[model samples]
Target: MTETFTYTDDLQIEVVNEGTAKFEDQKPQALIDLKSWISDEIKAGNIEGWLPYNNFESSVTWKIIPK
Candidate 1:
């Protein structure tokens, strides 16, 4: 499966996983990779003023796309 992460707001992140509906079949590693990438981007100052520390209990909305 493929995953896409979009920043819907300063503190809200939306995740769309494509090509499957079964939770058991979904790739857990993909989500972990996405989180790592986002964290790295934030630490690198790529997104100015959008620090993880500033967003308390940020929302992560997940969606699954049917094959």
Candidate 2:
């Protein structure tokens, strides 16, 4: 399962995998289409602040769910 969490600032997104939950210091840098996610969050009014990825933590990790 993918769980997304945000701090006071919404610029950074954290996706956590409940199965493994391994934290890594580096993640594959790429562009992500978060239109739907952002829209949902905005509707709920959870968004707080905005910042560049450079200002956020560069490390993240998620686990594969077993079938």
Candidate 3:
């Protein structure tokens, strides 16, 4: 199933009937944006947690700061 959604501020992403999802690798653009967003969000005292996900169960997990 292909799930698509946008990011919102409330510290959680809204998924369509799939429950929240764990993001995969941070794309080139994602990496850049994450650096800034994460810093800002953390400073703002929104959420101090990290998200980690595996890619197709290959033992390769990517850590990301969700937007």
lDDT of 2 by residue, 1-67 (tens): 3444342352445454333333232232232323344445556765432322333553233222222
Can you write out model 3's per-residue Cα lDDT over 1-67, one digit (the tens) per residue?
Answer: 1223334463333222221332334356643554455557556765443333243231111122356
Pairs in clash, predicted candidate 3: none
- What lDDT would candidate 3 get against the real structure? 0.37
lDDT of 1 by residue, 6-42 (tens): 4543354434333334223547974565567666666
lDDT of each: 0.43, 0.37, 0.37
Instruction: Specify the highest-TM-score model's number.
Output: 1
Instruction: Find the 10 residues in a row with the least total lDDT in model 3.
Output: 56-65
Instruction: List pairs with backbone clashes in candidate 2.
Output: none
In Å, residue 25's CA in model 1 sits off its true spot by 6.8
After superposition, which runs of candidate 2 have C-alpha atoms over 4 Å from their true positions? 1-10, 19-35, 48-67
Alpha-carbon TM-score of each model against the true structure: 0.37, 0.23, 0.29
Rate residue 8 of model 2 by lDDT: 31
